[model samples]
Target chain A: MPLDPSFVGRTYPPTAPYQVGREKIREFASAIGATDPAHHDPAAAQALGHPDVVAPPTFPVIVTMAASSQIIEDPALGVDYSRLVHGDQRFSYTRPVVAGDELVCTNTIEDVSTRGGHGFLTTRTDVSTVGGEPVVAVWARYVIRGEA
Target chain B: MELPAKTFQVTRADLIRYAGASGDFNPIHWSDRVATKVGLPGVIAHGMFTMALVGRAVTEWAGSPDAVVEYGVRFTRPVVVPDDDQGTEIEVTARVREVTEDGLTRLEVTATCLGDKVLSQARATIRSAR
Candidate 1:
């Protein structure tokens, strides 16, 4: 079965706010070996004009990936999670994520198509403060490979 | 302009830690048993983990932690990690593709593992140092 093309351009509601914790940012930064002070020390981040410890550029994936499940897990979409492979990823940031920020994600199925026995799905996530201030836009392309 | 190369070590432990922190507890990133069952050489490193390392490289090149304005990558290959103390290594290199009038530098980045290209069309735009 193929994913419904109608899902394209369908946008989901904003998810519940996810509190950005300093320790979680620190842990993520540490896992990637990003030892920059701005990722750990709030004072250092403040010096850089951020409200608190700043997350690495890719940190929003933590929020957006979870939000995307609303679409991928949609029964009507016909997505087969077992065959999924990440095709690509991109991010555009309005500002670096800072600890203590309350963020929410609104996910949209930007495209859905099938070619050569594979299903291609693209999702865009709008990450913002719970107050509706835009933070970043994250896009992900995933492929569901069909059996030979 | 050419950017200095940066190398990152990817250990199985790092994969486990990244999985826990990122909430992407995908078994292919851990649990060799499942990975092999799924036809992978073994447990592999997460693609996002690799991208994050490249982001760190880009920021380091731009001389600031918050310099990246945009970044993107296509996962061309899976980085296979053998279960060993030494794990594996990824080497990142980039060239300045352009410097815009608005003071952003565009980078064309290449990431490789085991002498094979692991990412294609990998690029980043960053605020150039003053």
Candidate 2:
């Protein structure tokens, strides 16, 4: 099924605040084998001017992926989850995410198109502090394989 | 200038751990049955996972965890991992694209697995280390 082109430019409500945890950052760092001391030690991060343990650059995906469910599950949009594959990802950060920050995500459908028997959907997620300080803008493109 | 290349090994166990940590429990990354049903080569690593490893390499190059200002990648090919203890290896290499006067360094990165490029147009901009 083709995605609803009308969904382009549609923006969703801001998600509830997600509290970033030091442990969660540590776990993500460990999982990726990121042994940088700043990713694990508060003192190390503080020396580098961060409030707490610093998250890796790709860490925001954890929040954006969950927040994106608002669009992927929309009955009106008709996204077949089983056929979806990640096509592209990008992040532009105003500042690195810290362990103690409370973040919120606002999802927007940036583009929807069909090409070569495949459906392509692009989404932009604006992540910011609970107080509305922009932290990063994340973009993802998903390709839905056409039926054989 | 060319940054030192970094190689990371991807095992099935790492995928499970990443799934638990990242909240991405897609069966195509773990269950071979679902992966084959979906026409995948085998249980594949999450694209985010591969990106994370590249992020690690970028931070290492910059000598700081918070150095990255912009990062992006196109998932060009799947990094297939067999159900083996050795698994597969991903090698990441980067070249210095430019250094702006404002103390930012731009890098053009490439990631490959088994001689096949897995990511394309991979790039990053980081705060230059003092």
TM-score of each predicted structure versus truth: 0.98, 0.98
lDDT (Cα, tens digit) per residue for candidate 1, span B26-62: 9999889999998888898999999999999998998
Give lDDT tens digits, candidate 2, residues B1-130: 9999999999999999999999999999999999999788899999999999999999999998899999999999999989999999999999999999999999999999999999999999999885
Q: Compared with the true structure, what per-residue lDDT tens digits does model 1 show for residues A1-148?
A: 8788988899998899999999999999998999999999999988888889999989999999998899889888978899999999999999889999899999999989999999999999999999999999999999999876
Interface RMSD of each: 0.5, 0.4
Q: Any runs in candidate 2 off by more than 4 Å, and if so which?
A: none
Which clashing pairs does model 2 show? none
Report, for every candidate in turn, its global Cα lDDT versus the true structure: 0.93, 0.95
Best by DockQ: 2
Worst lDDT run of 10 residues, candidate 1 chain A, spans A1-10
Docking class of 2: high
Question: Per-residue lDDT of A102-135 in model 2, one digit per residue for the tens?
Answer: 9999999999999998999999999999999999
